[model samples]
Target: MQAQTNKTENNTNRATQINARDQRVVQTVGEAFVDDPRIVCRDVNVFYGEKHAIRDVSIDIARNQVIAMIGPSGCGKSTFLRCLNRMNDTIDGCKVTGTILLDGMDIHDKQLDVVPLRAQVGMVFQKPNPFPKSIYDNVAYGPKIHGLAPTRSDLERIVETS
Candidate 1:
């Protein structure tokens, strides 16, 4: 009985230490905001049914700057990213709150159409499956569909630049 109690105390102490360390890391990392932000997220929260997936998260993404979301699996990184473009709307019970702004415009506004929003903010999935098209066609798909390039040569230029 004494050995069992000692083991339990050791496990509790280890868990407390780990939780403290994690809190420090979360506090220190990715808390700075930029002067000119391309995207801003304020007081964001996400819920799927009864599960609170994300809570009170805020961040800024600046133009021409790359940010990485680093966390363990099932830690709401993907959920938070999907919220940027209102992708969570597809799920039946998923709910998002707070403000997500793209160039100072609220992305979750009723007037905003998700189709154009998705075209503007692209997401690359983890799975690798080639589109059934020539490399040039695949590359030009977005610009062509969005009317960004009116002519073939324009599309070629866009693809080349990209």
Candidate 2:
């Protein structure tokens, strides 16, 4: 009877341990995205050569929310925005470290292609920087590149409306 009692206690202890571990895993993931966030960054550091442009910045943007980051000029608002779409990749000496996650996926991972990433996250510049070409050319550029138009007439219609 004592042996049976010991076996039952062991099973109960094992079940308790498994439950604790499962709770911990769920808690850890929940902490990563607070308030139902869509984007989360932790310990995010960015540098330009030896100069640290952004340091240890952590922020979470919840779904269907608007966040405006306002500060003095050169406080890295545009720099951080550029980091989102990997626009800084084009710069000569810019470097970024740490991690940025979109839907809990690492965006800064080297394997991730920035092309489709930028396409998914659209960007409207500060001003309407029209293409050096005509209004028709400016509107047709994206449609043509993305193969949205089959013929020149289709491109012309898009240009007229856009």
* TM value for model 1: 0.62
On residues 86-133, what C-alpha lDDT tens digit does candidate 2 reach at each position?
A: 767656688877677887778888789777887755555554555345
The lDDT, on a scale of 0 to 1, for candidate 2 is 0.59
Poorest 10 consecutive residues by lDDT, candidate 1: 1-10
In model 2, the runs with Cα more than 4 Å from the true position are 1-33, 123-162
Best candidate, lDDT: 1
* Residue-wise C-alpha lDDT for candidate 1, range 82-150, written one tens digit per residue: 888776776678999888899999998899987888867766656543444577777886787678999
TM-score of 2: 0.56
- lDDT (C-alpha) at residue 84 in model 2: 77
